[model samples]
Target: MKNISKFIKIIKTLNFIPVLSVFAISSSCSNKINYNSSTDYENNQNFSDIDERDQVLNIIKKADFVKFDSEDINKIYDNFNYYTKGNASPYIKIKKSLQLFEKYWKIDKNSEPWVINILNKYDGPDITIDAINDEIIINKYDKNKTQEVNNYVEMFGDSIIINKKVCNFGYDKKIKTSEYGFKIISYENDILIPYYIFNTLFLSPNYINLYYDGTKYQLFEKIVNFDNKKFKNFFDCAFPGITPFKEIREDSYNSLKFLMNNYYGLNKYYEYTSWESILDKYRDAMLDINPDNYTGAYFNFFNSLNDLHSNIIIPSLFNYRIKYYQQSNKRKTYAKLDNQLKNRRSLILENSDQNTNFFGYLRNNLFISFDEFTQNMNVKGKDFELKNLFLSSILKLKNHKDVNNIIIDLSTNGGGDLSIMLWIAKLLSKDKEISFYNYNDLNESLIKSTLSESKFSTQYLSKDFIQAKNILKSKQVILLVSNNTFSAANLLTSIVKDYDLGLIIGAKTGGGMASIMPTVLADGTSVAISSNNLFLNKNRTQIEDGIEPDIKLPYDDFYDFRKMEQAINNFQKTK
Candidate 1:
């Protein structure tokens, strides 16, 4: 009984999940990439015709190369060790890591050279990062010698200023580091910079020996090799360093356990699974920690949690696991659901005259649908085009005076921007204000928490909203949802239901309400977990378990527009 009590306590305190692993580092840390020594730096003779050779040269010369002395490097190492004490929680460790990165690395100003170098190496667009002037100048190399493009991204304090406007919406001034790189974190969202850029520029020899080396240039070379059809180099780069296998295993296990224990919101709700027992079962098999063994253990652990929002984000591990999933029949449910959603969307497109999959209209009813809230995953900036498209779609629908219905299909949407979702809710609702609450486990204690609510008013100046209101005043609004409708999409569905803005039809939504918190492990592997921000309805009830449909339909009916139309019509007649 005492042992049982101890086991339970362990289970509660150390919320264990399988963490995906990749070759973070191998024993060979000193080996350098053999770049062509003949490559000229002064004249930029190696640069392609498409490259902004002069601009790149000028940027590199202007940007100072920051070098750390031995003492400075030691201090960074000591601080990291002090912050990531064995007793400290993962949240504290992560927070400390961020603070350390910010203190040691003046990334905001000094990051220009590294950014430019990366772009140049990748054969990316001819771009210039002028830190002196505090602007990122992008010029597309057009063969036609078209009018010179002068797109600029500027920096002001911690905010990213673009075109003289502050583009930092969901960003706070705090710098958060991940394995991929670092990001500026806001309470609601984050803008992630590409991986390895930070470490490539800042990591010193001492730091590399004690901590992890990012090996940015080496990784880039591997990517180039892959592009050139040299697959071996790409795969070999996965495990570049000489870090001991045993140490890697231990660090991976401990870090994942710590992260999940403190930050994962669904811990109390999920059935306790003894990760110790699971690990012990795989202990002997995983003694030889190759990619296969490492991946198997971590993959199983992650799979056990059944949490979509939480997972490891190592590049090589992701590549390995994706290949694994492709070959294996495991997790077939997700695959099937993905295929079903694709088929349904394809069917809708086939039936409708919509040029794009984003939105359409049929039989005087305006249908708005998009799979993700983001316009472009690569561009970490405001998407004016997406916003314009959404607004124009509403206006187009409203222009049809005979139309008396608006149908929003979110069955296939995996979710994206929270702000966009709220905006959609505000546009459709009759109420002047829409309110939702969030419960955040700020202390990482999982007990004492903070409850906060956000209230959005229908104050948008878009003329489309006026038209939207007119349409809402007369037309029936219907929301189509399914088990696949997740994250922001699910949240949108919940708002529509709670506010009585529309009649919801289809199936229960896939719930993923918590904002994602990304952090790096001790091994330098990046991972994201479902944060402590548990979303709540108007009554303060948790919406993480998913919102049930007002009128559930057969799964097949979601794909059949005719059936959906018939159902909506019948429901209206009954009303």
Candidate 2:
């Protein structure tokens, strides 16, 4: 399950694509690719591919299996005797239960009506992964008294003997016991398959992935691991296309230095030009720096990007105060423009209470006012109430002869789940599927994505679309835009424009079409990277470039209802 914005508050709080469900439970995005929906594993024997390690494991399975079930536990212990014998496989499958979690970052830049925020998702509790191969004997037994995972160093030999290095007294600690566990993977609609993300955090899942292959489960892909050897553990791409920032493990000070060198880890492009100089100032003095100093340094680093889509987020539970830094003058100007727009919005909608409804009408202009992409809507999870609210509004406007024009106002909307986009699209067109594709730079394929998909996503979306068969067809649509319109919200405008559903009006949107994911530092600090690149087509040439209004409105006249009123009338006349 994948939603690249897995580790930051700025992107996290902005109600983004609810996917992979921490291995997310949410669903649906683009075209007819059946994609890896989570439900495929809703009943999976967890994340173990025992079939691949049969040669290495002497475990047993029941007809219906839960990886950590008591019977499964008993069988592993029953076979533990064999595992101890020389004849048994060389690996010790650590029979332990643990739950892993992935976090998210949100796009909170210095702008009006947009605040800095981060969202967190845990992979759930008491979840464990299985280590079935001799490779497990090689990879497991994290030393440091189980505090830190040690890296595997290959011994130069005819058969390539490998050994784990001694970092301190911790290296002496080892796993004497054997048992069973299971792996859980996260997938995203932005990405088709879950990529291997290997680090100290995950040394084994980095090596293999299991797939359905149309019929039965099989070893879909095998990835090679790379040794970062910075701290104690190795950093490698566990997920094929998405890898975490491994250099951060080298030194606490090296986090920004490493990321600046590889900013694409969470983004497609690097915006900072002073990287060499910035690194020169901060790289060598890491050991002496305080946490607040480190926080300031990272904050300044992100501030330099001047990118609304990206930011440096400190974990909320960790509750570290990020030392505030002043925004660049260029950033200040952008923020000012947004303030003006908000003021103008106030003047135009003065008569209407702004907070009550997500959709409404003012005179002949039917307005769909959606401000954010969070799941905490009228109701929770399914978005059923929000759907009905929007659908009902559209239906009412369609019947009202006075409503000859439509204004889909997404000015303050910061985008949440992709399904919400499709649900809105369902009301606009008869074509149910929001057909599109993406290119993952790491995977280098249009068909693949940064995260794995789940059946749950596909099934739920398919059902949601099916239920909304009739739409407000052929109505003249005019979309309102602003600089804050972003991510999935930005995508909504792009989709509407791509399908010729409407005319865009206002400023160009924030262009952050890439799906981003997080990687953690040795200190448990998390930073993110744009693990996947998104494109609008199979050729991978075009992407969801920020939307430019077909009819650009003047900045000063944003508050002037006459401008929008005239545009709506002019739009209707042309229709």
Candidate 3:
């Protein structure tokens, strides 16, 4: 089995997923991006007017973005080596190459965006990458043959070097971070195809000199493998030129502050710890480190985040947050909860009515195992009528007289699409009410806009789900959850608990309640922060501790059939 532990499923999501390809950016990195209503971040801004858009546009347009063809890139490499001759050392090349890559790649940190790239051989707009592997499927709703590719990719600290390269690497991750950094291929005539895109825009960006490091020579370059032509740039410096320490420090501080203010839900978990205090601790820690040590200072800042998602990849930086990044190789279980999760499949009851089935599982008691909030293939936004399988399955159970309770297994699930969550919530509600209000960090305009739109993206419609009724006329629900239940899944659990729609039967969910917002550092590095603290209602039903269960059943090796029966029976007595 692949050694992937998801409890610490830290991610780099802009809206929610950050491991995605930077495919939506424009061709040129230097040209300023015009931030419009469409730059999705899970939530949208109510942006007072077009002026707000213009204001953002004016700020970002200062940068000139450009694209370098393969020939241009090859020429630059040739010229640099020719000029340096035998005199240049690898150290010199390293520094010079960085500058050259920065200039030519137009890697303006404030504007680069990462998006899911789908190179479909058939027709249709590509499916966005909200989550990878689990939620992402190729041509999910299409009738085309699987597009062939050399099932090949090289992984770097930040970006994946696919056969369809975005640009030549100065180091490795630089090409992917630049405005011309990501690519996708669309196949029409059966042969493999290639296409590329980059997002070139930013607004109210606090630009900084991120590459300026005082202890420049201390940079560990061994981790990177430079080709022969590129290797000449790494010159052994006879004249050591260290970047000023103050420069890196100032950049780090300014960028950190801007991120804190923009993260809409940064204060939502203040009860857990204050963002200000956390920032202070890290900022203070930076002082204790060697002032010239930008790497250490930057690592410390990254390590101090309350957001696990923030623990994603930073270019040239490996697993500095080892506590969070390291995944367990062994698939063994230790805790009682772990045992329950391990044995969850065996413990579930087989449906009495085999006719009621969903995604292969027999929905006897109307069990829908929503492993992820992924959309079905051929499923379009708000087009629930086409991909409303879960709803139809639940409604199928309603026709049966014996079905009185439902079980939704959200165990081992990481969140996916917001629309999936909303649609499900709408279907489960008996009173035709919204399950919860979602918002983005610091953007009050977005909260108001979300209130107005009542949907996350402009792609959704209230009408699609308006027809959704209580799939269960009056049946109770038993949610099977654990620490794995997170993000949009956590929101669903809370709604179930808040609305008294179900009895949470397992461990408490891992609350990833706030909207995950990705912000770029001055170095063009991006990571996601839990920016919005949303609520189901006025009670501010908590998202952090996750939804509490009515019957807190610890996991057991053998399925606790008696306990389940007792809990269900006990609930029926009360009802």
Candidate 4:
């Protein structure tokens, strides 16, 4: 009875489309059209007839029905049977399963459960395949045969071909079966269409994907292995627009469906009372039938996936990190200049035995508080521009003379814009020119940064963007730093210590250093590309080890101001 009804169902589906009769074409259109010269005849042919045929061909072409040759199709079938014929080992069985999966899925990056389910059957005790309700779980096998997976070449007479390489799998020993019985990768996801995926891929589905993942409707691949010619003819009839007699197989249908579903795997899930109820009540959506709230409902359903890697979204949300950064820059103009200037200054007193000034300020002379540095570029936020504020403060302090021998503390400072650091260095020197290391040309690379008497980094180094080479040659400087001082902060410290520009006294600095441009992905996610590698001073020391201070102060002594004061007093007396 079931077999009888299957034929009836196919007939019913065929009712809407007209099946082309070869006899009818031969009788009516043979005189006017030369089948052999069909391409040329298209121009001379009746435009209306040509358009009709084109539309029919378009529909047929899209339908998954036919393929190029019988031999290619048979090869897949033969391969499956060959592996299944013997009581093959788990590895061999897995290979056969993967062969079928590849044939079905073709080429895609991520894992699709439909294809993965087939592979589960071939796994040893280490893998368990379960379909409870409408959910499919593929987990590690329980068997503890912890032997590494051997190379296919080592195990078999022939090597496994991957990316045109024979037995390249041995390069990474980790991928080879470790002390485990077999190499396995497990994944978990709610079933989309329990009936369809399970039946087509797993060969069984106990329940429909109704209440499983809150999905109201699910799409499934329906694969039919038939005689190549018969399948092609059926495909031509069902979808007349698609060209007939093309290569079509179960694998082709599986591959196309896999791509579409994976590419458009809607994050949305449907809520239902039960799996049985969904199959009985809501299967029509799979057929692409129209509903009342068409567009809105469709989009709402589509957006449910929420996965940026797999799901689609509106234009606004696409490439989100980049857009946010751009938007932030646009709003930078609205930020008041004075507020930015106020934030750059770090007010701290330098207590020296011979110092005349109190509340001695060593401003963020670099980039003169981020304002003068990031001046024209549109960027927003106090946190994002925290370095700018520090620079602004340093600039303010450079001109104030109530301050004497400066103490520029990079102790806990993580690092920021290199331009800002250079500015600060220039201000400390008091000379119009200050020479510092250039990352690009370290062999004998020299940069002269400049500062105005009143402002931090007021001048630029024209030679290598030099502005203040003279002032740095004259000032008495004390540089304080610690392990937390890293990146941009470390870069500045490296210059101060190497050139003897300042007396650096503290613990080793945090060495994290990388110069990279930030790139925002289409989904508004930001990523940094660390392409250029920057090195330390001419000593050839790498930044990864961080900059060690010339004088290593006791950790407690540095933190205790009273201890530091006593130490400074003792030094002054000795002088």
| Every candidate's CA RMSD | 16.8, 19.9, 18.7, 24.9
Please give the TM-score that candidate 3 achieves against the real structure. Answer: 0.49
Q: Write the per-residue lDDT of candidate 2 for residues 50-85, one digit (tens) a residue.
A: 343233223322111112223332122121111111
lDDT score for candidate 2 against the true structure: 0.38
As for lDDT, the candidate ahead, 2 or 4, is 2
TM-score against native, each model: 0.57, 0.52, 0.49, 0.30
User: How well is each residue in 1-575 modelled by candidate 3, as lDDT tens digits?
Assistant: 01111011111221233322221112222222223421211112233332331121111111122223444421212211111111111112222233433422322233112223333221111223211111221112222433221111111111111111111111100111111111121111111100001111111111111111111211111111223222212222211222223333334454555455433354545533234556665665443324334445555565555454343334212111122333212112213344445455533444332211133223346555644565542221223332466546655654675766577777656676655565566556664343233232222211110111222322233332334344464676678777767777777787777767668877777776655544444332334456533433324234566667666666562235456667668866987
lDDT of 4 by residue, 25-112 (tens): 0112112223354331122323243223112111111101112233443121221111011111111122223333443322222434
Which candidate's TM-score is highest? 1
User: Which portions of model 2 show Cα errors greater than 4 Å?
Assistant: 1-250, 254-278, 285-287, 315-319, 322-338, 351-357, 376-384, 448-471, 533-539, 542-545, 559-561, 568-575
Order of the predicted models by lDDT, top scorer first: 1, 2, 3, 4
Q: In order, what lDDT does every prediction score? A: 0.43, 0.38, 0.37, 0.29
Taking all chains together, the TM-score of candidate 1 against the true structure is 0.57
Model 1 lDDT tens row, 1-575: 00000000001001112222121223233433224421121122323332232122111111111123334421212221111111111111222223334433222333333232112211112233332332333223223322222122111111111111111111111112332112222111111121222222222100221122322211111001122322334334433333325534554555555455544656545643334554565555443456565655555665666776666544232133233342123235645775777676666666332222455577677777666665432112223355555567676754577776678878777776554555566557664345554443322111111111122111223455546555576667888887778778887787888778889999888787666554544444444556544555655566777899877788877656678778877877887
Is candidate 3 or 4 superior in lDDT?
A: 3
Q: How many backbone clashes does candidate 3 have?
A: 36
For lDDT, candidate 1 versus 2, the one ahead is: 1
